[model samples]
Target: MHVIAERLIDDGVLEREFTLGEIPGVLWTPPSASASAPAPVILLGHPGGLNGMYPRLAGRARQCAANGFAAATIELPGSGDRPRSVDAEQARADLRRAVAAGEPVDGEIVDRLVLPLVEKAVPEWRTTLDALLSLPEIGGPVGYSGGVIAIGVRLALVEPRIAAAGLFAGSFVPRATFDEARQVTIPLHVLLQWDDEGNDRQMALDLFDAFGSEEKTLHANMGGHTGVPRFAGDDAARFFVRHLR
Candidate 1:
């Protein structure tokens, strides 16, 4: 792990930008956080690719820190300093071709586009979790939020370190991931944009119905994929607070 920069931001949150291996991310800690008294941590993931350091992500981290927690986000595979993998690129190209042809982005395209990313990303998230937890300023009762909803599903199933998760349900889910969802029993807050033009509304509902978590909640709003109102985010933040704090 390499520390590239560290500074205090809004609400006295300490933002440290760094790279782990080829993955770059930002770790936000509260001003009072220390190894002797580490703060609760949340792993924030974004859709499509690694988003690196961005406003929404940093804003969420600041909110987490202000509410007495630490938040971190890592670069996903095939993005950022790393180039897109051949297989992932091919899948994306194929999806584009199908979408341009007015064909639904389902079936083989779903497997091709979603599975490869899921296969690579879930373990990478787990690895990132390991590295983040080893840090002195971060501690357990971790929470996860944001996209490539498949990543959230898989992490809920595999990463025992995560105490809870806030999964965005505005992306296509692979057929096999529904079974994986059955294995996830953590406290989950699943967010959905009911009128999302780009997402499969049925898939989101089906996948939510498939979760094995007894403590899961579905938060749906009438909006497009990115048109989710601020209150929905506030609801998710409150959910994280209940579990992480």
Candidate 2:
């Protein structure tokens, strides 16, 4: 598909920080000459442990833009160029407090700190969705994807405007957050590697079964944790076309 990279500014929506105080994301759309009467939109979430401007996620955004959809990829709080200003010691203290309070810690220190940030950022995602839907360029359905960006999907469910969703390498959803996925009614597509480190094949199967939507699918790629099926490239494009249209 045709692809181009461009920046978007405050066309109409205000540029603001997420609740977790992350860098701002610009809204993207098709150029006026090439866009349809109304276009679909996708809100892309980047994977954890990488700069917010991860190439794969950005590639997907460009792909979506080329395929006639308005796509927005937001940098989560404390990631990308705006690394978390919170000191390591202070972050450790927050984790200690959370653990002492009987919050789930699961042997992963990052989760302890990131969960709270995800919690705070959920409402910001909601507001972003509202703003996206309000744009005249976005008229079709909405979709979401991130290798580990399912946390954003959990938050996106709070808004009814989202019509479909896709998750890549999303292995964990805390028990408290499990209810969020269970409540969504739209179609869901999950892409997972056969040997993903974070989420195993069985876990992906379990999540697919748990989804409330009758129209849910799980796709397995032969690649390892990061290697996805080449089909994924096309699957994602078609997934948007089938549902967003």
Candidate 3:
């Protein structure tokens, strides 16, 4: 965890940009965080491309800080400044072409696009967790929140350090994600955008139903992708506060 830069964002939230080998990431810690009194951390997830996602990620991070928690997010495999995967790029192109033509996306394209990403990204997230937890100012039990829903599913199922997850259900969920979802036992809070053009609403609901968690809640709103309302974010923050505090 090599911190490349640090600045105070606002309300005394300290934002740090860092790199782990080739992967770049950002971490935000609240003023209350310290060795004597560490803050619980939330790992923020996104579809991909950290640079494009920074503003929203930072807003969520500050919200986490406001709620007395630290937040961090790393660029996904083949995203932002990382080396791109040719296979992933092709699969993404296929998806976009299908969407542009108003044709139903083939399941094979989703499998090709998301499955490998899940396989590679989950381990990186676990490694990030390892590094973050080692910091005196950031401690567990950790919470995960955001999209690339498949990544969140895999982490909740396999990563023991994650106590709960608040997943955004606005992406393409591979079939393997449903299989994994059925085995996840951690608490979950899923947000669904009913009118997201790129997402299959039924699939999101089915995936939520497949979750094995004894405690789970779904928040469905009438909006497009990126139209998640502020109140919804407030609700998610409360969800994390209940579990992580």
Candidate 4:
């Protein structure tokens, strides 16, 4: 991990833009934080890509800092410094066909378009965590939030370091996602935009229902994907506090 730049954002949050190998990203540390007393950290994921970092994920990072935690986000694969793999379009076509046909996508299709990325992404996140927690400004009791829903599902199933998670469930879910969700027993707070134009409503509900976390919550709001009320962010912040603090 290497630091690219560090600066203060609105209300005095310290935003440290950095890279893990080739991954371009930023880390936000709360104001008045102690290097000696490391603060808890959150891994903030995004729906679109790294371009979603500023103002959205960036704002979330600042919020985490204000609520007394450090937060960081890495650019997902096929986003930012990473370009889409050769099979990306084929995978999309395969998925569209499967969804249209109302059948499970073939395992090879999953391996090509979706699972490979998930496989690559999960490790990068773990590696990033390896480097992130080592920084004196970041401490334990880590949490994960935001999504490319698949990544959130996979990490929740796998990464034990994340003490809690707040997942945005407004994206397509693979058939295997529920299987993964069923293994995630950590405290989870999922945000759902009820009428998202681009999402399959039943899939979101089903994925939430499949989660093994007895503490999981589905925070459904009556809105399109982007219609989430501002206060919902506060509610999620409180959820993190309840679990992490």
Among the numbered candidates, top lDDT falls to: 3
TM-score top scorer: 3
Give the CA lDDT, 0 to 100, for residue 88 in model 2. 36
All candidates: TM-score: 0.94, 0.74, 0.99, 0.91
Model 1 over residues 106-152: C-alpha lDDT tens digits? 67777888888888888877877788889887888889898889888
- Candidate 4 on 16-119: residue-level lDDT in tens? 88888889888988875678878899999885467755788887888898888989888877765587776776787887888788785565675566676787
How are the candidates ranked when ordered by TM-score, highest leading? 3, 1, 4, 2
How high a TM-score does candidate 2 get?
0.74
What number of clashing residue pairs does each candidate have, in the order they appear? Answer: 0, 0, 0, 0
TM-score for candidate 3, residues paired by index: 0.99
* Model 4 stretches with alpha carbons more than 4 Å out: 93-112
Candidate 2's C-alpha runs over 4 A off are: 1-22, 32-36, 48-52, 83-114, 147-150
For all candidates in order, the CA lDDT equals: 0.85, 0.62, 0.95, 0.84
Worst 10 residues of 2 by lDDT: 12-21
Ranking by lDDT: 3, 1, 4, 2
Model 3, 93-175: lDDT tens digits are: 99999999999999999999999999999999999999999999988989999999999999999999999999999999998
Q: What lDDT score is found at residue 208 in candidate 4?
A: 88
